[model samples]
Target chain A: MDSFVLPSFISPNSEDIKRRIYARIRSDLHRIEAEIDRNINSSIPLISVVARHIMGSGGKRLRPLLMILSSRLCGYTGDRDVSLSVVFEFIHAASLLHDDVVDHAEFRRNQPAANTIWGNPGVVLVGDFLYSKSFLMTVGYNNIRILEVLSSATTKMAEGEVLQMVHSDNLEVDEEEYLEVITRKTAVLISAACQVGAIFGGASPEEEEALRAYGHHLGIAFQLVDDTLDYTGDVKELGKPVGNDIREGKATLPLIYTIKKAKPSVKKRLGEIFCAEEILPENFLEVREMVMRSGGIEYTLHSAIEHVQKAKESLDIFPAHPTKETLVEIADYVLCRRV
Target chain B: MDSFVLPSFISPNSEDIKRRIYARIRSDLHRIEAEIDRNINSSIPLISVVARHIMGSGGKRLRPLLMILSSRLCGYTGDRDVSLSVVFEFIHAASLLHDDVVDHAEFRRNQPAANTIWGNPGVVLVGDFLYSKSFLMTVGYNNIRILEVLSSATTKMAEGEVLQMVHSDNLEVDEEEYLEVITRKTAVLISAACQVGAIFGGASPEEEEALRAYGHHLGIAFQLVDDTLDYTGDVKELGKPVGNDIREGKATLPLIYTIKKAKPSVKKRLGEIFCAEEILPENFLEVREMVMRSGGIEYTLHSAIEHVQKAKESLDIFPAHPTKETLVEIADYVLCRRV
Candidate 1:
């Protein structure tokens, strides 16, 4: 996934770039939404209800958007692009459902999690339903490569989640271990999304590898930004609490960096708060102040921008097209998105 | 699945019958075990640990056994039977892991559940790993029908679980609704096992239909026996606690039958115990006795025997061989086996 970091300048006019990319892909995004709605329906009423509850909850659909734009960038002219885009959304949504259950998350997208409303069993099974549905959709295309990409991605994603659980609340987890977790848990699926689109577009192996690398760096950059935002983001914009990662005892990049840079006394204090039976509000606030004072957020943002620069560099091999421009703009957008 | 009831003489010597069937397939069963052991290994250590914990637990591997034996019945001579059988075991193990999490089950096969040891997040993610692994295995052979059968079965199984949850603790759930739940939850996967084997064995269309019917009926009978045993079997023999279905607020076939046949006062008492906030030991005993007096166990057993007979009858289309005889004996064994 090209894990080593390099520095680059962030685009100051990111809002204009984001709007331009959104305007270009606006129609395709709507088509992807339609396909998602149609595919989520089930004969069993509860499956539909629980699935729709999560599907309608406002995920940015970034994975599917990446897939569709990548397909277009590779000059895909077939009608299957929207259908294939549905596969990414289903996979993304299914993981979110299971993720919420695993994390015992109360709120998702500013609403109660599906587990809270339907109970854990129903939520878990619906996640299974969505997963199988994605596979079912894949078979209709008679494409073995798509199935291979998705199956491997899912296995790695699950492994990443289990690894995260093993590292949960451990104050000794290092940056390399944290990077491995995010790459497996987050980057692999996004990479698959872009690679599968290239395959469908009939891209050469070289083009496919370039797109895969692009997605890998962009995904890592995206997650690093998310981790930085956990300490610095507004609760209303983030759709959850500000210090949720602290409350959950997750050792994200910012927290890991903060622990590394803190004074000995502050390190012990942060570790006690992080490894506490329950992190009290005052302790959480103190940990947040310590992270900010240590310049953890800025350091994490610098790392994200490095990955984003690498992501844009991977796309330089492709010819200049509007779709290619949108892809680059989306990579830039990952660094600036609030939610 | 032959839902209608019929009277049949109980086999007086099931041990002899079970021995005969097991002796016929003993070699193939061992090979399936080896395949399961090989396939369950993973890059992430905890997946292997959690998977092995459940896979080594005392499941009879009934679904995979059906697949292997059915393939042999169709005169399969190749090694793909072992590989195909692994898919069934993986699917069944994945469902069991998720089931334990959903049920909050403390014990399975007289040992603590994976969720109890690893926590729900790890367990749920491992279940996902097994599922994706199964699909990954299927793609190696490039068989589309096998994928379709498995994908459809998994979707139906999830729907069945949600349907059962919807009908939980409801006295109004009828025999038909109960049949639907068991068919989707239990029978579809078993049917898929036999059908996939037939597909692999190069069976004719008529033979495939016959084998599919055989599997479907046998699965229903197997589940009916399980529901009856919930009320009447010994705890040690069952390998878990008795009356577990009742304690879990499940309305199995026996409970549905008893609710239909009970006297006015007995019905009220049973309802009180069932719908009570907490069912005490004495209350549980009363519910068991009332079910016995209402002939719920016998009625459910009769229903099971009828399905077993139908299962055996479905084999008439095939020419008689040792494998076919063993399949018939296996169906009869379903009527008499204790666990």
Candidate 2:
């Protein structure tokens, strides 16, 4: 509901801050990656093969990183953080596999999507395996609250996907409805990751909420940038062509904005394109250009930047600490990332 | 690993016993159905639509019924049994939704499969919704053991599907591997249902073990009968054609037995049919007759009857009670059910 507004608190050295933070967390990230590899193995060779195919195709481990950083920000020092971090990764990986199947996506993270290689049924089942496996791993913690948060996040995520499906390709979708979709589909998991990290770190309720807010805003910003990048990012970095969202008839933030802000003639043309049975490559590029002309990309980036600022502001309740600084840097990284 | 050897324990009047048991538990079963109906409700209308479409379709509510009967057999006299019964049903229904997509099944329980009506993406996501919703419900129990059992069952179920995929259309699949697949895919959930019911019912460790074994054997018997029904039952009652397993290239117990006992020429023909790109309807009928002539149906029924006897024998440790009697009757019903 909040408009994109930059507060007076953030530093301009985001890139420099991210570089230092990466160096500090390098070993921990390695351990998390190792645990992720170990956790995905199964007695069934194909399950392992399909799981490894996607897991090995690296995406930035942003969700797991949030859990780790939030734990540190809460002044927690425990070995459990490493394994706990892997839980969100499994959930994220599982969702990506399913999403790829749902989207009929060909590439993910600069590689062929798991569905493209293993077929939809195998990918779908493996996604289920990862999901159940994540829950199984959480039982070792013996914490009901952790399970509650994780399970609730998963439920909301599924609901979010359904909501997105309900609203798919509907040109009437507004900013508020789009926000709801991204919140459920993407932000809930990120928020849960941070909240669970706080819970494991023994933070007070207030502190937990603060971190949760930070993660929520960060996740929203992350997804906003993701949607904008669908029209703006380079193909090599995105591992797919620009205008894919349009091809799939997804009314993402930029396109939705474009529809609202464009001239009547432009809107009419956009409607014609959307109504067409096949969206040709040239039409896709034409829509991208029109969206740019209508300032949709800039508006979306502005919204994302505002969310990044709000995310950093949410962390102001926490005391100044090294981990808190890293969290701020990650917030900046989300805005600055090209893919 | 054990051979299917019929024991001298099962009563011949399974149908009469089942009818009496159903008469007694009529109220409890009704309550469970209501809870299941309540649990499946969602804010998303489409999700509710997709979920209800499948949940309302009449498949035997066998898994949830097992949980309720197992709870009652352990002398559980609480309302939790009714709500808890819904958990296994949600899991079972969720698995069925996904399985339909995986098997590309057109019909289930005399209705078009949810996947067929809602499309695969919506059905897959709704299945996920049910899965997470089920977990969310379990967290309300605040019992870590319940979470453990449910999560483990889900993991094994996913693994079982993968194993089945690996074995699909492969005639070399032996009985041992087939049993492993069915156990992971189908038996584990039933076993978890009973074990979870026991946990909620305050069963002693030994009592829990007995119920768990009862469920495991009953699940095996149930699946054996299911495979046999695909060969022997009326299509209207089974809610599917008789040659579906053969069409899908699944090597169920009946087909596996037929492969093992058929004459060399028959075995070669069976191999050829399985290897062909598409199994013709006439060929499917021919294979069915061959399996029948090779005594495959009889062997599978013998195996199911043995499991039913084993399932009943596992209940010997429990004291005589009406609930125990019902549980025993249900075991026999698993053997004799036509659909």
TM-score of each candidate?
Answer: 0.95, 0.95
Lowest summed-lDDT stretch of 10 residues in model 1 chain A?
A: A1-10
lDDT string for model 2 (A228-328, tens) is: 77877777766777777787778988889999988899889998998788899889888888887787878888888899889999998998897888888
Q: Which regions of candidate 1 are displaced past 4 Å?
A: A1-9, B1-8
- Evaluate all candidate structures by whole-model CA lDDT and list the values in order: 0.85, 0.85
Instruction: Summarize candidate 1's per-residue lDDT along A1-339 as a digit string, tens digits.
Output: 111122245555657877898798888878888888888888889999988899887778888888887877888877678888888888888899999998899998789988999888999999998998888888877888878888888888888988888888987899999999999889999999999888888888988999999999999999998887777776776778777888887899888998898789988988788888887778767887887778787788898889999999999999899888888888888887767
Query: What TM-score quantifies how close candidate 2 is to the native fold?
Result: 0.95
